[model samples]
Target: MTPVNPESSTLYVQSLATGVQVLRAFNTQRASMSLPEIASAVGISKSAAQRFAFTLEALGMLKKDSQSKRYSLSSANLESGYQYLQCHPLLERANPYLLDLNQRTGETVNLAEPADDCMVYIGRFSSLARLIAHVPIGQRIPMFCASTGRAYLSSLSDDAAREILERSDRVRYTPQTVTDVDALLTLVQQAREEGFACCHDQFYRGDLALAVPIWDAAGNAVAGLNLSVSSTSFTVKRAINKFVPLMLETARLISTTPPNPTALRPFRTEPRGPKEAG
Candidate 1:
């Protein structure tokens, strides 16, 4: 039966849908909502909402504020959303460009989005390897250490980047990983100036990933496009001379699109070959 009040339907009963919906209800503004507030926001009974929140927290979907006993969403939701957009039309507008890029660069072309504290590889065009770097589509890389992460981070506001960095673990992934906050801040500044970011073996062992940011109509870096090669195939110099320009071209094409994101198609994966690390 329809609710007597339309507002009530949006504000109340629909809140009772599932654990997922309840988890989604938490956002930046509602960061630390109390159990009762969550119940009202999702239109669920206090007991049931608390149960769902507890379950979500157990699963790392929600975090309970130790001080206030409120709840907020964990980074897992961001990962799920990134994976969804990766395969959808969100990357469609960029597929042809990526394919051309892969052919021209003769390397794996990857599209990524800011997922949790890292830029997760979403779309991939593989050649010479079944998939480059053995990085699954859901794999997470450190924002400060990966070229894709830096490219997007450079496009974000200073405060936003620092906030995320401060909230993250900032663990040392490799000897090359820039775990120093001050140094990363400086690198971010350089990336903003140069219009792209490059990292060699920072995100993964002996992996070279170069990336540029794709902006939305709002001028926000909504996505990142990258070319990844193993330490055996291309040198940092070769990536810059041969691949950077085309990668930037793809980024520009995608950034110039209307508000909606474009989708990019995936090619083939091949065996890892010999190349120099960038």
Candidate 2:
């Protein structure tokens, strides 16, 4: 769980924040945990962890094993995410475009938005071909290594992109992951000039991806649209030559359409640390 601000606004509910923290403790890696483990992971007392666990269970967001007493997230927990996706007009508007791109390229396509120092996948369309990486919706990848992240950064000024990179953890996920800030800045600059970003096996060993930034009517880069293929099938240059034009066209279409005001809320950045690359 992320630490809370000590000098937060008076309206802030610390208890509710803590409860949410407890819920976030469950992830793909640690799917289930005992009270003591949760307490340790969340930096809370065992009693506090117990209360939060029980409350979440009662709220139908979590489930506990009767025999082992280990807690795991319940299917009901996905309802919140489902509701967000259902109401998000950006995803609704971009779905057909992403689907078309996926069908045409026969590769995984994704829509992501910047959140602090990373890009979070909000929508995805998988290819008919075998997937090189299985990145689910809501998965976060560092800005320094992901094509979507670099594409989003390309929409910003160099100074602004540098600030984000400075705050990032900058962990080298693979041999191709560029941890050097200067090298990453060069990549972002190239993307800025080229109108798109392309990465080969940076985050995933066998994945090649290209991305273009999606802008709002006001010209702010509100999101990134990406197309990813297996490295074994196509070289990075070939993928870019094939799909970058299509991605740019889709981005232009989304930009011209007025976005639903309420749908923009979830894309807003919140304070959080970077996640280890998948």
RMSD after Cα superposition, model 2: 7.7
Candidate 1 has what TM-score? 0.63
lDDT of 2 at 170: 91
| Top of the candidates by lDDT | 2
lDDT per model vs. reference: 0.72, 0.81
Please give each candidate's TM-score: 0.63, 0.88
Q: What's the true lDDT of residue 215 in model 2? A: 78
Residue 26 Cα positional deviation in candidate 1, in Å, after optimal superposition: 21
Give a tens-digit lDDT track for model 1, residues 1-278: 75767655556654345786787677667777898998898888999888989888998988888998988888887877676766676478878888888887678888888877888777778866534467666667778777888888887777887777777788877766667677777767656766767777776776777787887867678778888887666666666667666776677777765322222212112222222121
Residue lDDT tens for model 2, 80-162:
89999899888899899889878887878999998999999999999876888789999999988999999888878899999
